[model samples]
Target: MASIGYFLSCEQFGPKELIDQAKRAEAAGFEKLWISDHFHPWNDEQGQSPFVWGVIGALSEATSLPVTTAVTCPTFRIHPAITAQAAATAACQLDGRFVLGVGSGEALNEHVLADPWPSVGVRLEMLEEAIDVIRLLHRGEEVSHHGTYYEVQDARIYTLPAEPVPIYVSGFGPQATRLAGRIGDGYVTTIPDADLIGVFKESGGADKPVQAGTKVCWDRDAERALDIAHRTWGNQGLPGQLAQTLPRPRDFMDAQALVPRESTARAVACGDDVDAQVAQVRAYLDAGVDEVYVSQMGDDVEGFFAAWDEDVLPALR
Candidate 1:
């Protein structure tokens, strides 16, 4: 059976709240955890963006469930070598139960240092080079790389898990999906497109794990749940490329205004309907996703967990 995990939204909750959610997820019988790695929330209304690495440290002590960064950008903001070190440390802390999920990244977080945001092609090229550098350093031998996009000189990770960390590459389109298949240890994406999963497998990702995530709003009041989903995560309804191209939360907020309430209604499963929640997750599983991580968008986390424990998880399993 495919695994069902909880997604801890760093973009929506602070560090302490995330750790608490981790523990709650484990207690509620969620098999694993996926956490967002973001420098900023998509918008101020979503409200929080804690540094992911520090929160991962606390999660290591708080929950035994495996953890994966839904995706991290090693191409910009932070060098691949530094990312390798951080991933290694996290793997050790989790006792080899961690996966480093990487992506080409968005301008939202990458633009913070005032660096130019390259085009999609250039970003993917840089991401490929970054992964190469990270893998070399993870070998525990001094690596001096002078690639077109990055230069790592005599860098070696001193602390590492018994095994090298598994790197899962995130891809949303055909080009990036093929690249993920060619180089990634596994694949990560949010959409449940069976065609893309086929593309990944044919491009050499066969036998590797494929992970995806989605969000839901679980509340007793169905209408109120939809309202919260629209307000807090309406960014999900933004059209193509806007999410990757927009550089600031305000820009996203501005674009978010165009997202109709109906779009969010179609995108997210809301309310206390057990059948609705089960079917939403089953959509990903039917699309060949090996693991599906679900995030609750409402504030009533305890209610969400109780519903999952009593009705949703049992039905899915």
Candidate 2:
């Protein structure tokens, strides 16, 4: 009974391309959209990183699907106040069809302001504070506060949807999952693991929606698909906090040199095998995920969509 959503990669596509994909996804029966908000692509080869807010505005005009930031970091580079305003406007524009997804964030995007990156513990603390500020602002009141990580003086969001924007928190660990349960309207993660869902629900996230996303490349030639995933996203296979600590795309490129192509092939669902793609979706469903967002990773986006719409999606339904 889980709904399927399309994940639009802002790091890989230009604003127009993303809008176009959003339209195609809607036509193809995708029910919702998850969009990444990043200042930079994981690696240079992925290229384009458009300002996510502007793209959201364009998407408002282009599609009717509900949208969520698959996620955004509101603590650094951009203040929580500004993020609140942006999310409010997006909610208004989309007619209450927008959800704000937030996380502690990676150094790659946050270090742009030249601020010293805090440790993981500090980042999580900052995330909590940022969430507090955003929720307060969404109430449409003049908010003033001085907190451990942020300060606000008479800040108010003038434009907002009738309903306050729902905020979903993203995490990859148990502590963060608990935090999401305590504060988030919903939960988000990339892995399709039921234990994470149990963690979220056990703490306080019970009855709330849980979202998960995965990447796949649909090509007839499996080897070609594997090569594309490795060249552009091999860094994704990095372990531990390497993804969070890596500061630049070049740094990722250098680190990914050590990741074997076989690793990327094993991790990502590649090739035109309909059963394989459907299996990927089933994992999320089996994990009790409320929503599954899938991203097609290579240039075959059109082909991927066509195949999924004609085959995979029907099977899932």
Candidate 3:
């Protein structure tokens, strides 16, 4: 059976709100939590971004739900060695109920350090090496390595959970999917693409969990919900590598303007129809996903949670 979880949008909410949401989600029958890690919101209209690790720290005190970074980029904005320490601490705090979801990262967060953004090929190579560095540190041994993109000198994570933290890799395409299979303890994606999961399982990821997530807006007013969805997440419909390559939130806002509201509507399930919400989540479960997470795109998070708990989740269960 597939597990269902709540996706906390750090890009759209502050730390307190996310912690509160996690507590509510656990109370509402959500089995796990996926919190996004970002330095900035997608656009100013969405308007909030908090340091994800801090929020996770607060979440550890507030709730017992298993948590994972929907994805963190240890390749650029932060060094892999440091991420290893943070993940180790988080695992200890959560009593090993933590997974580090990592990816190649986006230019919007990575370019802040003024490092020239490398091509996707280089980014992927860096991600592979970064994962290696993190795993080494997790073993609680001092590690020193000089790699093509990163260098670490005698780094070790002193605090760790009894078990090594499970690392899940996120991908949007075939190459990344293959990399996730070869290196990841699990796999994550926003889209419910069965073919991608098939490739991951076939490419040395057999028996590993396949995780997927999506967003929706639930309101009595369908048009209002649609508007909120479009405003907050229109970029979800942007095609190609635009989501990754764009260097600023404004670039995303500008590009998202061209994305038709109709497209966003189709991509995000809107309004308070419990069946619709259930169907959106069902798509991911049917796609062979072992875990499914859902995020609400607007301010009516309480309403969304209530609907899911009282109506949607029962059907899914």
Candidate 4:
């Protein structure tokens, strides 16, 4: 069966808001859950960036829906060695209901650690090594390693899930996609593009889950909603290589300021109409994703889900 999920941006709302939203999402019939892990909000104006690992703990107790990070970088800020410990503990806390979604990482945040950002190929190498380290630790083995990018001395996880923790790899291009196929238990992505799936399969992945997510805003006034989205988060729509390596969230604003509002709006759907929202989600399903997650972009919760319940969910069903 094709499953539907809800994604929450960890940095966008506070703990109370997260708990409330998790309850509301479960009530709305979302079967899966994806939460973002970020140390910083794109801009300080976007508000609270809570400790996501802590939020995941509360979420595990709050909802029956399974939780996974959309994608967490186990490179900088936190090493894979510690990530193994955290994920292992989280899995136990969730009672075997957690997936460890990891990736090569972005320079915008990781570079803040005073480490020089390497080239894409180097990042991929680090990611591959990180995966090896994380899995070994998850297997409850005493891991000691001295690799090109990481060096960990004899470590073993005291708390691990009864079952193995599945690792999901996020990829955007062919190289990363191929790496995901070669090593990941599953694939994680935002774009609903099947070419990515094929890349994974050819590289070695088969029959594993592929999850995708998109954004929508539920508002009574469509124009006003679009304006708010474009102002605060429009920078996300920027294209090409240099955009992903930004040093700060404000860099997004400055670069996105060069692009037109319509371009960003193309990625974010806002409506007072439910049919329109359903169609946006359908595009993801058509792209051959096994699961889809919808993030209602703004803070207007009551208004968004009411439309989803009345209109979108039925059409999808």
lDDT, candidate 2, residue 306? 92
Q: Ten-residue segment with the worst summed lDDT in candidate 1?
A: 149-158
lDDT of 2 by residue, 1-317 (tens): 68999999988889989998999999999999999999999999899899999999989999999999989999998999999999999999999999999999999999999989988889999999999999999999999979998989988889989998999999898988999998999999998889989999998999899999889988888889999989988888999999999999999999999999989877888899998889988999999999999998889878988998999999999
**Which candidate, 1 or 3, would have the higher lDDT against the true structure?**
1
Q: Estimated TM-score per prediction?
A: 0.99, 0.98, 0.99, 0.96
Q: Per TM-score, what order, best first? A: 1, 3, 2, 4
Those runs of model 1 whose alpha carbons end farther than 4 Å from true positions after fitting are none
lDDT of 1 at 63: 93
lDDT of 3 at 5: 95
Q: What tens digits encode model 3's per-residue C-alpha lDDT throughout 1-317?
A: 89999999988988888888898899999999999999888888888989988888889999999999989999889999989999999998899999999999998888999988888888999999999999998999988998888898988778999999999999899999999999999999998899999999998899899888799899989999999999989888889999898999999999999999999878788999888888999999988999999888878888988988999999999
Q: Which model is ahead, 3 or 4, in terms of lDDT? A: 3
User: What TM-score does candidate 3 reach?
Assistant: 0.99
**Candidate 1 lDDT, 1-317, residue by residue in tens:** 79999999999999999999899899999999999999999998899999999999999999999999989999889999999999999999999999999999999989999989988899999999999998999899999998998988888789989998999999999999999999999999999999999999999999899999999999999999999999989999998999999999999999999999999998888999999999999999999999999999999999999999999999999
Which residue pairs show backbone clashes in model 3? none
Over 4 Å off in model 2, which ranges? none
Candidates arranged by lDDT, highest first: 1, 2, 3, 4
**Candidate number with greatest lDDT:** 1
